[model samples]
Target chain A: MQASNAMAALALAVGASLALAAGSAGAAPPALDEQLDGAAPVISVPWNVDAAGTAAQAETLLAPTAWAEWSNVLGIDLRPGGSGMEFTSNPDYGTFWCSNGSSPAYAYARMHLPHGSTIRFFRMWGQDLSASGDVMAKLRETCLPNVGPAATPTVTDLATLQSSGSSGSFTVTSSPDHVVDNHQCAYVAYVQFPSCDATTSLRKLRVQYER
Target chain B: MTRTPFIAAVFACAFLSSASDAADFPNRDFRVITGVDGKPARSDDSYSYASGNYRCTNASTRATPHVVRYPFNLPEGTSVRYVSVYGRRTSDATPITLRLRQVCQSQSASDPTSTVLATRTPAGNADGYFISAMEFSPSPNTLDCRAWVEASFDISTTACDASKAWIQRVLLETEPSDRIFRGTFSVNVDYTLP
Candidate 1:
């Protein structure tokens, strides 16, 4: 009876050690501190007037055609010139300004974030290019869950920048409902004229978000 | 008895390694399906059926004259890495310029309303039915092929989540002049998932 008891005790000890090892191995990585509000992430694309010197240069900086390249080029150029464009920390805000020429310009800024991030707020400062026409800004999101030939993505409009006249600045905050499941998001700002001759200039633009 | 624990450890290690090696992002390929004639099939599982001859009257002026669209879906954590297109041209001398677009469910259902992603003109070969391939970088700043004319937007994001997303669609228009031709084309996409 003593021998049998010894064998049972040995078995139990081995089983317990194995269970402990398994538990240690399965432990998850340390969680990020949720209490601290880190610096907001920022992605900026400053406008390069030099790059747009020629049609081909504009196409290279923008796209193939005039109509297709305008908005995309403007989108990349909205950043403040110099070292501010560097993406070192998560920036809570961004600035977009354009003052030169105006011929019904539209711009978009796109960024990719870790999935499940939330956009907390947006701040805008702008001077209307035209006294009669209004400028509009929109926040758009697209999510691609699986990357393959069979994969489809969902697109949603998170928010819209309130229309501003020739001069004004505004700040808007997003609700918790603004959280996104996908990784890709963008901000589109456009200025339309009543006539083909109208033009608009954007002096300031910013966005804030949390991962 | 000790050998049993060692075996279990080995098994656990193997499982963990394999799980890490498995594809985080899905890769997909589409191919052409030919008929009995051995030529490019007009309508099959591989290609979408379009009425009438695929013609480009003023290829240079025509705005997305002949567009062939293939629908796809990307779940949540995945983003595009590279997109490649392969096809044949009727004349090796006549280069074919094609534009690739991404149609998101939230954006637009129609092909014309979709966003233009990239454009490429594959170099032609002497052989009439020679296969040509072109690749596009996932970034809007770079072009994988010299023939690429434009890089409008990048698809490196997890936001493409929908049941009916148009992953790839080609807009065929005449770049040099008017032309009418029948050819076969397909797309292969590489992606990364979290």
Candidate 2:
């Protein structure tokens, strides 16, 4: 009964929010009224968040120690398409630093953390989900593994981004362009349950914006 | 025996009523699951059919700023009454300040020479090192609507800087008020058009 009620309440909240968003459609910014008369803004962008074999090999998966900090950073609803964007549209280039997990803990950034401790593919930008961005990517194993002891998962920043160039910069004055970040957690069957931890993590991703 | 039809009628009525209750707009935002594959020639990918109020947040190392031009298809003459900016930090981090600006695009952000529609500096917002405006000018054809945030953290104060930015996903609950901007942990609003 509680679960059903919770689900119903959640449904209502989403409905309300969407209704709020589902207004007259294409409500142009007041400042643009004087500029754009009647034309659709172009929307096009590319993404890049591929992690090349650098995940940590672990036996169990527990929330990262820095989960609070990570969650705080990702939980706050920034902007719709994305928040605090670090890329320059004109230059279409930028970089960010991602270091290893401060501790052996992890978090599901408002988004889903991959299953089996894997950080799988995650969307870096989207009007669809900027609201829930901190959830770890590809983590379906919600219940922490039960073993003699649980090992905290760790994350390490493998590289420094020089530029985040979009694949195809189709100017989008209305929509959003996003990049995905990949984090991988290794699972050790031989080690036993509650031993899952992050194996490889890609800290920063870069995308280009262009014609 | 003869009451079977009556029961069926009642059941149908109940179902319809329940559906109506669920069909409301603010009731539940439509969440269309989307995915991207190789290309047109490719077979394309398979995203599960999802029914959620919102989409998942994009993961990034830095707190990225994303601005989406809204209402992709509003009939011509769709004059906007107001515009607002809503934000919230996904993490447990407290006080993730957000700054909303309404500056002229043609005007220079570098030179600070453009005319601002409604600067949040005087309002509940601040004029950070990096602040852009949401394109709401009279011209609908102009590709101008935009928003930005200073995302880096202050080494000394340990606060989020609006000047620095990232390319992560951002969610919008509503819009922002003309006089009010910058949310603590999270924010939502309807917007100011006048």
The TM-scores of all predictions, comma-separated, are 0.29, 0.23
Error of 2 at B159 (Å): 6.9
Highest DockQ: give the candidate number: 2
lDDT of model 1 at position A182: 54
Q: Show model 2 residue runs off by greater than 4 Å.
A: A1-211, B1-23, B26-94, B107-142, B149-155, B159-169, B172-194
lDDT over C-alpha atoms for residue A55 of model 1: 16
Q: Return the DockQ of model 2.
A: 0.03
Report DockQ per prediction, comma-separated. 0.02, 0.03
What are the runs in model 1 whose C-alpha is more than 4 Å off?
A1-116, A121-131, A140-158, A162-177, A181-211, B1-83, B92-94, B97-121, B125-194
Of the candidates shown, which would achieve the greatest TM-score relative to the real structure? 1
**lDDT per residue as tens, model 1, B78-140:** 123334443434331223544544421100111011344565655444432323233333322
Worst 10 residues of 1 chain B by lDDT: B181-190
* Chain B TM-score for all candidates, comma-separated: 0.32, 0.29
